[model samples]
Target: MEFDLDYLVQQLPALRAGLLLTMQVSAIAILLSVVVGLLGASARVLRLPLLSPLIAAYVEFIRNTPLLVQLFFIFFGLPSFGLTLSLFWSGVLALTLWAGAFQVENVRGGLAAVSPGLGEAARALGLTRWQYLRLVGLPLAVRSGLPAMLNTGVSLVKNSAYVSAIGLQDLAGVAFDRIASDFRAFEMLAVLLVGYLALVLSLSAAVRLLEHRLQAPFRR
Candidate 1:
């Protein structure tokens, strides 16, 4: 079959829109994951009486399950319980929860890496627990975990393709739809491969730049 470059070019507008939606979902989900990670990690590290076990369970459950199953549960299964979310929000929520699980471990590991003597010294200097965490612990933990967190960010961007399963018009969905209509499977797939590669590569570069900036202080 002759490759249809013209047909692929004609679909650029739709592809662009799909890419925008993909980025939007990934950005929001990553932000939410950071929030969840920080809070979950803190609770676990501090061993908060009631919250620690719950966070641990959440992390384990999400880590153990497939992301697609989680998306399906949010987008499809919730309606049966009289809770319905729009497809976009459902995808975002599912990704957030799924990525947040891994983020929890990344953060927990970072926190654990902090020298125990540092905490003891902070206490000796008459710092309150909250003060020590805020002024000392949080920065160190984030610095240590930045690479893992950025990796999760990249994974989220790539996995955003899964949102297509719920009929969200992300890049994969758009590519699939275009192929179905034009019957140009190779052309469409090639375009998708390029699109995702470009996106992930761009994200990786940005993360590397940010990682360098964050590490500058520690390197001194």
Candidate 2:
């Protein structure tokens, strides 16, 4: 097989552009997931009668169903309700919804790690419910949750590749296009495979650094 390092290098600009889209989708989805995680944790913990039950039901449904199916339903199903979104918007929205489902569990686990004494102390101090949750509970929970949230972030980035199937030119999509254009099938795929492994490995390392920082404060 003839090699073309220069040609591949030239494509880097477009590939980088695609990575930007991947990052955008990831950022928006992560923010949405965090919000969902917080809301789910609060509702489940406080046990608000009606809202609690509804959120519980939502979590169950989301966790049980497949994300790909959910994406299809939103993209294909929403149009039935006269709601249409761009492919990019649809992909981001679908991922956010799916990530939110799994994130509920992360939030619950984090909140559980908060020492009960802290909450009690806050209550004794006459902290308002909002103050107790915002100032006390969330801060403690965030520390305990760091490792798990990082794990979820890794999963979210990997899953973002699926958006390529729906016409979003993410990393995977760019590689696919390269294969079509160059006919360097094996070479293109090998590059793509290694690129993903590198991406995930680098992200996992960053997460480990963050986990270490979180643990540092607790060390005697």
The TM-score leader among the candidates is: 1
Q: What are the Cα lDDT values of the candidates?
A: 0.91, 0.81
State the TM-score for model 2: 0.88
Model 2 clashing residue pairs (backbone): none
Q: How well does each candidate superpose onto the true structure, as a TM-score? A: 0.96, 0.88
Off by over 4 Å in 2: 1-4, 212-220
Position 22, candidate 1: lDDT: 93
Tens-digit lDDT track of model 1 for 64-160:
9999999999998999999999989999999999999999999989988999999999999999877877788878999899989989989998899
Please, what are the lDDT tens digits per residue for candidate 2 over residues 44-153? 88888998888888889987898888888888899999999888898889888888877777888888888889888999999976788788887677777877877787
lDDT of 2: 0.81
